[model samples]
Target: MAGTVQNREAFLNQIAERLGRPRITKPVERPNWNFRPQDEVLKSATQDELLEVLKEQCKRIHTTIYTTDNSELSSVLNEVVTNYGGGPIVTWKDERFSHWGLDSLMKQEWPNQDIHVYEWDHTKGEENIAKAEQANVGITISEITLAESGTVVLFSDENKGRTVSFLPATYIALIPKSSIVPRMTQAAQKMREIHQNTGHVASCINFITGPSNSADIELNLVVGVHGPVKATYIVINDL
Candidate 1:
């Protein structure tokens, strides 16, 4: 017992010595030495230039981008639906969507198509998720569009469920021109501001660059293995 106690104490002392002393009389100060300078092009670029940059960036990452006026949004959506051959649709139940008259537009475009709107009610949560998973297309409004990497920031709340964008075969996002930002830093700052002002934030913040892709098995690039295969972003300028 005495030998075991001595060995345990020695082991603990060895660990403590390896870890270094806990208390210090004078603590060392650390300062950030590397600083990322603000992008001059982003800072000085006009709205139109920014839009063009975002479009090019999205294209590079296999994301399709379409720009249109608010009045033509319905027509563009109609075209998208027609191109996709018209199937089941899953949409966020956000009031902003109603304000955009998307419901009426969708009804006008595909009256007979099955449409599921994600609700805040927990009773229908499973159903909504299932619908989203099986839907042909999932549509939602992008909270922020990061131009640098062509990423859309989605705040998953009651309306914007996590799987709504991932599970569907195709993902369509309505990005208001005003939501486009120069960099992800701006988007993160805006999110922090929203949290600071409202004292609440969404449960998940998803940054989607393009459609799901993986080059793991045999190094053959395969898309949509884990999420939506096609990603489309409709940028509404006049909105």
Candidate 2:
């Protein structure tokens, strides 16, 4: 076994040495495509206007939104489970959600309903994938995301698995409005900063715009092909 490992290492070193001095190609430059957004791009006439935009987006994709105080995220979560159809809610084993009183809230809300809230821990392997697949709705709080495009960025770290956002039938994201940026580039920059500070590159960074949809098979347009059919972004302004 030791001899085989040594041979593999030596082979890898030889390949690295051979490819070390390869020719460097000139970087291609593209045309500057700076297009100005419309006057109403990110600016809203009022809070109602912003809420209307959120509602419209949710309507376009056949989803629902239930807003609540950011401090009472647990209560909002409970309301979601209680008011909506009963289903499993997946979240990371983070302090934010736990400290927000998730367990007590779940108990209060799902007294009769068979609701399940799974806290993901990587030590247990890929069991959350199956749970998420069967769940009616998957709830998660993003690290940082954008509201302009209604996109949620789920970086692979700790208990915040990518499958929780993608595999479920319905995805409910609680994004603090303060974290919302106007552009995708700004979001990417924030992610880069996170990587630099954490010393861990995200294995999977999902930028989800609304729900999963397609118009391929006979051009009829189908939803829920590769991911959730319905997605709701509950932007909390008070967070």
Candidate 3:
């Protein structure tokens, strides 16, 4: 009942009557593009090359990017979190953190250093929101990283709330090198694949570039005006 469309049939019928034709109820197949320049851009670049593109875009977006292998990932993460004034750190309830070899650091090492950690729990509801708002840093694993625009794509779920990334003073993303794509063209294709293969997709998908930035009516440039004042991404080469 939460998302039920009560008047959709009637509304679509009215539009069909205006057009003197039947409403389109079937999904249409996407057309083939003869010349898609987007797909051609950065298509041949290797993973290291894509990393370079991401590094350059990070400068424009005012984001700090770090590259390391799996063996050094946890160290890099610790360094960035500390640089952002350390915890209380809010993160998604994701197993990838453990799998990527950060279990001890996140669960034990940080806490031993007096850095509080809160893993978003669905059962807590608004309790999680409060924690996120007060958290000094929010960290999450990037579902898809785009090199062209230096964007981190997130698909929110029960264990992953939007606020974990939006409400904190600082944000950090753990990007697996394999997750890096040439650009949004590839990212969109991946999303399409997920929908086709899984029969569903997350309700909310976020494409975050960096810390919030805006220019006011006076034409003065402002940074971190809406969200986290700092954004950093750590790319694990062997993850």
Q: For model 1, give the RMSD to the true fold.
A: 7.7
Kindly state the number of residue pairs that clash in model 3: 0
Residues 65-110, candidate 3: write the lDDT tens digits.
9988878888999999989889999999998888888889998999
Task: Compose the digit string of candidate 2's lDDT tens values, residues 1-239.
Answer: 22434586667667777999634345778676677454336654345554555565666656666666657766666666555576776666666655545566655555456677676778778687777777777777766655455566776776787788887777888776566655476677677887799886677777777789888768988888988877766667654
Please give the range of 10 consecutive residues that has the lowest summed lDDT in model 1.
113-122
Question: Relative to the unseen true structure, what is the C-alpha lDDT of residue 158 in candidate 3, on a scale of 0 to 100?
Answer: 93
> All candidates' lDDT scores?
0.79, 0.67, 0.93
- Best-performing candidate as measured by lDDT: 3
- TM-score against truth, every candidate: 0.80, 0.71, 0.94
Instruction: Write out the backbone clash pairs for model 3.
Output: none
Clashes of 2: 0
lDDT of 1 by residue, 105-180 (tens): 6655466555433433445868888887778888888899888888888988766688878888998888988998
Better of 1 and 2 by lDDT: 1
Pairwise TM-score winner, candidates 1 and 3: 3
After superposing candidate 3 on the true structure, give the runs of residues whose Cα lies further than 4 Å from its correct spot.
1-3, 19-21
Question: Which portions of model 2 show Cα errors greater than 4 Å?
Answer: 1-22, 25-62, 217-219
Q: Is candidate 1 or 3 superior in lDDT?
A: 3
